[model samples]
Target: MEELTELVQKYSNFTQPMIDSLLTEIKNIQNNYSYRKFDVFIDVRNDYSHQAVVVYHKPPQVGVSLYQHKVVGKEALQENEPGVFHALETGLPSIGLLAETQENRLIHQRIYPIKFNDLVIGVTIVESDISNNILNSFRAKDTLERYNDVSATIQLFGRLDLAVTDQLVDSILVFDKLGNLVLANKTALELYKGLGYIGNIIGLDYNNLSLDGTNFKSILNHFLKVKVSKNLVEKKEFQYLDHYFTIRKLLNQENQQLIVLIQNVTEIKHKEAEIISKSVAIREVNHRVKNNLQSVISLLRIQQRRLESPELKQALNGSISRIMAIASTYELLAKQVSDDTNLASALNLLVSHFKQLNDTQNITVKSQIDSTIVIDSDRIVTISIIVNELLQNVVDHAFSHDQAGTIKLMGIIDHNIVTISVADDGSGFALDQVSTSSLGLTIIRSYVADKLKGKLKISSDSTGTTVAFSFNN
Candidate 1:
């Protein structure tokens, strides 16, 4: 027999310790083969490709083997055995599904992951012949008979329904034309009993047990009068005393019986409500934060009016502009109630903020940001500050006296990389002549590296200066 350890070393990315531990697990699976009559095997993803390799196989002690020959060390292609790779990649089990064998035979498979260090190292698949169990699955579905009387329905379900309906997790309830409950499954009886219904519900009206209190006459009128299709199933959600449930209603035309399937979904409904509540709370908090920042900017402007030094007034204006840039991101997040904001809307808002403050400069700012670029609110705030610094730098040094210039801001995303570039139509300066330790350059570099985890590139010529930086989306 080929060793599992040798196969792991040759075809998989498992460590030596992991391989040693896996050997013990393989032995346990081999020795403890149960009476479920299934052939169990282990498969690992190939190190360099998407294919999976079978490293171990344990044939059932009493069951027939599906494989005609040894399948170890063979590549399990996705088209043949997708459950093996699905468990290996997603760390979730794929159960009770049909899969094709290497020898071109169909078999039922139930696959689960083998995890080491929180990573799925391999998948363990349980194989069984579909011919033995496929009859039960098909019979359970197509057994809805066209019976006329209650005695016929009772006789049919008593033999077969108990085996099939009890295995189901959803509650099954059936009612006659007079709104009398004709048949109740084990799951339905247990579910209603837990909901405070006393005694047997086999003869009780379905509306008496219904949480929504919809009468059988109303259900028949709504379904049969409007929808003539007998196979059509109507769905609705209802909540009763904190328990949320979804119901599927269908009518049997041959006997004029109403059938409803109930599935408890209270946990799913609560989770959806919690997410919406948290999103709204985050939006409210962002709105309050934006208001506070705007108040601070107003206070700074009032203080700037009292200052006499030209240099102090210019410094205050720069601070106000940077604060406005940060506030614009919060405004977008507050209105949309999300963690990310539209890049186009954010850039347009920044232009409006800068236009309000630029009284002396006749430069016009035009933003051509892509509408598809969505950035996190926190990262966009950092980007807004960087753009503000570069725009102010262009206005200060890129133009001469009485020169009309335009600053073009562009945001482009290509191949999962986002590039925000700013170009101006004014006099450009030599890179070597500019100070290496200038505040604008230092701020841009620090924000791009620390906040964005990206790279910065500045290219300048006699035409114009373009400062661009790129980050992964």
Candidate 2:
């Protein structure tokens, strides 16, 4: 308890008295709920990251131990322990959040915020062992009750003299073997009225009902006569009265009766249409952006032809390459349905384009990029620029001797950090001789450190030069 208090004081701004009060409350909870393991965690806020540290732990007396080892100083990540953070963020108890311990054992956790003067300072988590048998037993009992209720409702409909209740949200109608309406709920009666029925539909023949000169009754009669397998259910959707409706047919024992259910799904259909409209709008925007960028590239090429100075032409070529890198991103985006762009595929495409455009007669370019690495489209542009600059540097300076060489681009992701390296097997330069003021190197450094929030490492020797960048995703 003393160590837990000191750890909380070291990580949080809560006073000693407040910490002591919280500890006492946790101990009382532990004494009350002796079957569950309880742990107190305080939020540790830092400039770079927000974390929670376990300040106190109490193990259960009669059940399996949730934590075999001490967690008095362990950090709880929001990703791994959402219930703990949720309680702290909302100041409300979070219940029944499933999680796995460091040892990979699944447990059910409930978290409550520890407050002092209406200000939440920490959270207390109650973890319990998950018993599958107990859960299955409760599920079975609930299922049985639902089945019994449905059976009772169906039996009530089997009696043709009874008037069914309209309490159900869905329209329910039961048809006899002769395609005669035996029972119809009030919702079903209202729907039939909309279909141009003027009188009682309880005794009306389904095959005689006319709907817009199309025997809609014949469709229902045909379904009633169709030999469906026992316990088989068929459903279909149609549009009516500017609303969407789903019809389901259920076959009872020996196909003696057919139960029809209708549900209105107009709101769900509207949501689906909205999603499609948004997708089409996004694709149209991508298409327009790509076309505009291509026009810019064409104008740059035309201007480059008019320039006679070699240095000016080279600078223009660099600018064109950067623009082309950005254009490639939109090109890929226009072709994809998803918002995330596969960085590996995009980088490979960029490398191939560079090799084809540049004058590398005997140079071989190889890529070891992971195809599974995908990132958002906005970040993809920065990554594309970074990759283009590093690869262009290799082509211009690494193999300036016109000797046969190889340039390899490798990318891998580890623990949410993406690492990309461009290595070349060419004449390497001394690190001390490299100028920090070089435009290409400076750009690479800026993009890596500032834009990506990462670090860039460049190593060079007689063997080769390898430039690597690491960033969090």
Candidate 3:
């Protein structure tokens, strides 16, 4: 009694007379509340705004206490106990209202005002167990006791106490062993409302709300049938009403409760579809470009066949080879799904194709590139033209008639710099004496400087010719 007076004085804005009025009601509740088999308390408005503090507590002496421990000095929130605040502010009585206690338990409260000189001083609350409400619920008899035992454990694992779960973006639901939803967070309830559910979803059968039409019992059985560990979680995607969802389901082995988490993924699916549509369009464009280049090559071959002079025939062949080299890039792009080609494979393909088209008993083209690389179609087309010119120049000028020679293509990469070298074991010419007006020299220098954005290096000796170019990879 003395502590109750001190509590009112320390925390509330009550007058001395109001404190006495509250203590008088607390004394009557402490002595007579046991007959009702309920927990009783007195609450007064605190000096802080919109809160009340419990000043006295009395547990039933005849039966089990609904509260596990004393909570005399605990604050009562309006969200949890609106009835308690109603009695204190309006000097009226609020009866049979469901309220959540500070210990996270639910009970029915009956709050009555304590007043002095027509001014409300405090509220006296009598709280009883909610077993009668549970009796009317459809949740199985075994579910009630089992859910109580594991509800705290589930909240701990999810980091979702009731207060915090209301603010989460992910919808969370927990079901009992009987396939009934024992708990649902505020987000889940709102999600169901968006899905056209007009009523509360708690205590409802889970099959009614499942998007995939998989019953909860069958889901549990499927996990066992797959020989998966009971602790292993299963994740899947679902669509309902044009909304895409990624759902994860897990079963708590200790209590056999099922937990479901759902997230909307519609925007992600839309983006993926857009990317695939663009990829198909790109592949189509590359195919048409390859066909057009091949047609041009056919026309050049026809012109080469009509000519009798060796110089005219050789000139047409050079044009055809350059077109063919560029065509190879589009051909590769059309065959694969990705937009970029492997650099090593593209270079090797060029080497193999060129050797087959111009192979001779006196001339051999070999690839000695040891490093692996990948590049895009644009750069590969430029490289193809460059490498073909270098090889053609070696065939025409480096070796004399009836002379046997070998050409080796080497591609090396070091610290983001790639160097391609075409070395030929043929009679070489002097670099200073060579004509600047030479067509092959002009093509190589212009393409390397402008298209490839790289440096060109040439070396010649009495024994061999090596033409190399370097670019940033």
* Candidate with best TM-score: 1
**Given candidate 1, what's the lDDT at residue 205?**
57
**TM agreement with the true structure for every prediction:** 0.61, 0.55, 0.59
Candidate 1 C-alpha lDDT tens digits along 1-473: 34888889988767877887678678768777372477888888887676788888887788678888999888877656755654665566765555778788877777878888888788888888878556355344323442235677665345432333443578888788887666766788777665544334565555455555465677888985786576566788877545788887777766777777888888899998999999999999989988998999999999999999999998888888888888877777789966788888988887788778766367878889899999988788889889988988888788886788889999999998999999998889898998987877888999999999999999999899999999998
Instruction: List the RMSD of every prediction in angstroms.
Output: 19.7, 24.1, 21.8
- In order of lDDT, best first, we have 1, 3, 2
By TM-score, how accurate is candidate 1?
Answer: 0.61
**Model 1, residue 350: C-alpha shift (Å):** 1.0
- Residues 1-473 of candidate 2 have per-residue lDDT tens digits of 78867777677777877887777776677667553434433333321346677776666666556677877777776546655555665466655555556566666676767788888777777777768863453345444443357666666555422122232578877667776666666788787555433334564444332111123354445655885554456667776434577766564544476666777677999999988788778878988897898899899989999999989988888888877777777778777777788988889878766766567778888899888899887788788889999888888888766788999899999998999999998888998988988888888999999989999999998888999999998
Q: What is the full ranking by TM-score, best candidate first?
A: 1, 3, 2
Q: Which regions of candidate 3 fall more than 4 Å away from where they truly are?
A: 1-168, 182-203, 220-232, 237-244, 252-256, 308-310, 356-361
State the lDDT of candidate 3 residue by residue for 187-292, as single tens digits.
7877766654423457766655575546777888986688655456678887753468888777665667777888878789989888888888888988899899
State the C-alpha lDDT per candidate: 0.77, 0.70, 0.77
- Candidate 1's C-alpha runs over 4 A off are 1-168, 176-178, 182-187, 221-223, 226-230, 254-256
